[model samples]
Target: MTVRVLVVDDSLTMRNLISAALRQDPEIEVVGSAADPIEARAAIKTLNPDVLTLDVEMPNMNGLEFLEKIMRLRPMPVVMVSTLTAAGTDVTLAALEIGAVDAVPKPATATPEAFHDLIGKVKTAARSRVRARSDAPPREAAPQNYSPDPRHVLAIGSSTGGVEALLTVLGGFPANCPATVVTQHMPANFTASFAARLDRVCAPTVTEAVEGAPLEPGHIYIAPGGVAHLETTPGLTPRCHLSVGDPVNGHRPSVDVMFDSVARLKRPMTGVILTGMGKDGARGLLTMREAGARTLGQDEATSVVYGMPKAAFELGAVERQLPLHRLSSAILELCADPAVRSVA
Candidate 1:
């Protein structure tokens, strides 16, 4: 089936360029184009397009605000078009949190390769599930016994829908939670901003991981995108080490790399595979399970994209699979279990 798309941008040139790129794909059909949110709102009602490509900066209303409205009133798949600037990155992240399916950076010049990439992202968005903003209910506080352990480490990996998933998981953590690391597939320019956003919303301190940074309890470290893999060094002090290497599983800061490195450590570790688009972390998560580390994977019903967790589950790597709402409690239970902790 062809995917019907509506392009919304303040610039006429950008709308034309995006329409042209999308038209090149046989599976995509450009249904309409709008210059701003007001026009886009009408077009949405009339056209009822399957996917929307929205510009971050638009007149009449900004993309983030419009996106929030859309998610609240009539949720639909939206892919944000962003510029490669600091401000644009910030807005794009906000768009994702507001239930946009994905984001594509607007190139300075629309090259063939860039246009092709945008087309791919739009197609992916077309198939994504668009939930109402109210679908995410307030999370009940985790039980008192769910507190973190100073000696334990938690490693999480995700891709496509990771930002929201990570926020949901880390939001439940206490100020003195265990040392945690994350590998999420994203552009290099976006990781720091994403971490900063996570820090503001979460109780734990969230920051992008740096070379030789000491892993402290109650702090979360995120792997910088477009850089080397983040790995743990073998030493008395838990330090993060960035290694320059070829991209594994088509990602530089690959989830497999982080999980493998953590498996080598002597401390108690918990491995979690969240919603993502590929099988990058499956093998490494299997290794972690074989090494007696407690492993968890997001269940299909709650995942935005079930690829990574499904892969891990099929491989017998994930010891337990649960919905997103229950994962925080499960993690705490594993952390508190003496049998699980004794495996270190």
Candidate 2:
């Protein structure tokens, strides 16, 4: 089926560029174009496009405000067009949390590669499952007075729908949670903003993973988005290790590489595969399970895109599959449990 798209941008040039890119995919059709949210509303009512390519900046009501209204009132798949500037990056991240399927960085030059990324994102968004803001599923309550075991490190991997999913999973963390490392598939420019956003909302101290950073309890480290894979070196004091390598499974900060490294460490840990679009983490999570680490996955019902988790579950890598809300408490519980306390 053709993925019908409505291009919404204040700039006529951007609307044309995005339209041109999307049109390259024969399966995608530019159903309509809108210069602002007011016009976009009318188009949505009339054309009823399958997906929306939204601008980060708009006239009258800002893009975020309109997006919020759309998610709350008429939830649909949206791919945001964003600038790579700091403010734009933060705003795009916010858009993801508000339920935009993905974002494409505004390019200085309309190169084939830049448009290629946008086209891919648009098609992916077309197939994604979007929920109204109010239709969020029941979430397990965050645990109270949680005790942490430093022996157990928590490793998580996600993509596609990770921004909102991570916020929910990490929101359940207590002040003294385990030393947690996360690999969320994202653009290189967006990871820093995501880390900062996590730090603001979560109880633990969350930061972007850096070379030689300590893996201590109550601290969470997120893998940077570009060339380095985040892993921990087991030693007198476990320290974060970032290795520059070719992209694994089309991702640099690949979940597979991190999980494999953690597996090689031969330590007790928990591996979680959350909502994502690919199988990057499945094999690595299996390696972790074989190495005596506990493994978990987000169930299909709750996943925005169940690709990675489904693959891992099929491989027998996931010991249990839980919904997004139940994951944080379950992860913490496994870490604190005596059964998973011993080293491999």
Candidate 3:
């Protein structure tokens, strides 16, 4: 399928660069360009492109406001192009909260190599089929004692395309769901906002983990930034622990680190590995399976990249593979089952 893209930016130079970059790929076609969000809105109505490449900082309303409007009115796949500055990172993360498909930092040097990478991001965005917010009912608060299963902890690991994936799964969880811990590969300063965003969209109270916070049912803890691992306390009482050690497999807050910790301390845990690139979680997931955990991997058909989950599945770490559309419900059913209950 050919990908039709709409380029949105305030700068004509950027617009041209983005359009040129997409045109390089035979599979992608730049259908339109907009100088600002207002113009982008008009273009969206007319072109109905498959994807949009949006600039974070723009004249007038700014990118975040536009993104919010887009999400509320006409949700679609949008790729954010942000600079490498602190302010840019802030805005980029905000874009993710507004439901952007992905984000790419604008290169410092405007070279051909940089343009190539930008094009790659655009192509990836075009391939995504984002579920519009208007299509589904707003997430509602779940009931108390909604968790059916009382077994081991709920472990979730995600990266790259994780922001959207995590929201979808957590939103389906009950207000009083099982104790859930997540490690999403992200830079420092981003995790707090990410957790806050999840809390808004999910019934469960979500927050970035702090040292020795008791792990309780119905609450979700996100691993703190700059850490490679988050572990649970052994025996009866479980709690959260964060560490800022060397990068494992080239990533801090690595999936492997979290999974290994869960495997060692939270046996029989429900392991969920979502969309990402690279092999961070595969080994740790395998260890989790060996420790008698019920492991689930997102199927390739529904993943943005399918690198992590595919690696884990090939290593026999995954007991079941599910498409993204079905993963949320599957997780709820699995964790909520009475058969999997664990006595403290």
Pull out the clashing pairs in model 2: none
- Pitting candidate 1 against candidate 2, the one with the higher lDDT is 2
Candidate 2, residue 210: the lDDT equals 92
lDDT of 1: 0.85
lDDT for each residue of candidate 3 in 48-139, tens digit (9 for 90 to 100): 99888999888887999998888888877798888867677767877875678777666667654566756656666665555555653344
State the lDDT of candidate 1 residue by residue for 1-344, as single tens digits: 89999999998888888899899989999999999999999999999999999998888898888999999999998988898799888889988887887777888776545676778777777766678979986654634444456677788999877888888888877666678899998877899999999999888799999999988787899999887899987667688999999999989899999999999888888999998877999999999888879999999987877889999999999999988877876776666536444311
In what order do the candidates fall by TM-score, top score first? 2, 1, 3
RMSD of each: 2.7, 2.6, 5.0
Q: Which regions of candidate 1 fall more than 4 Å away from where they truly are? A: 142-147, 337-344
Candidate 2 residue lDDT tens string, 1-344: 89999999999888888888888889999999999999999999999999999998888998999999999989999999899999999999999999998888898897545678888787778778899988886655556666667677899999989999999998888777888999999988899999999999888999999999988899999999886999889886678999998999989999999999888776679999998887999999999999999999999988888899999999999999998888977888888847443211
Question: Ten consecutive residues with minimal summed lDDT in candidate 3?
Answer: 136-145
Q: Looking at candidate 2, what is the lDDT of residue 161?
A: 92
Alpha-carbon TM-score of each model against the true structure = 0.93, 0.96, 0.72
Where's the lowest-lDDT run of ten residues in candidate 1?
Answer: 335-344
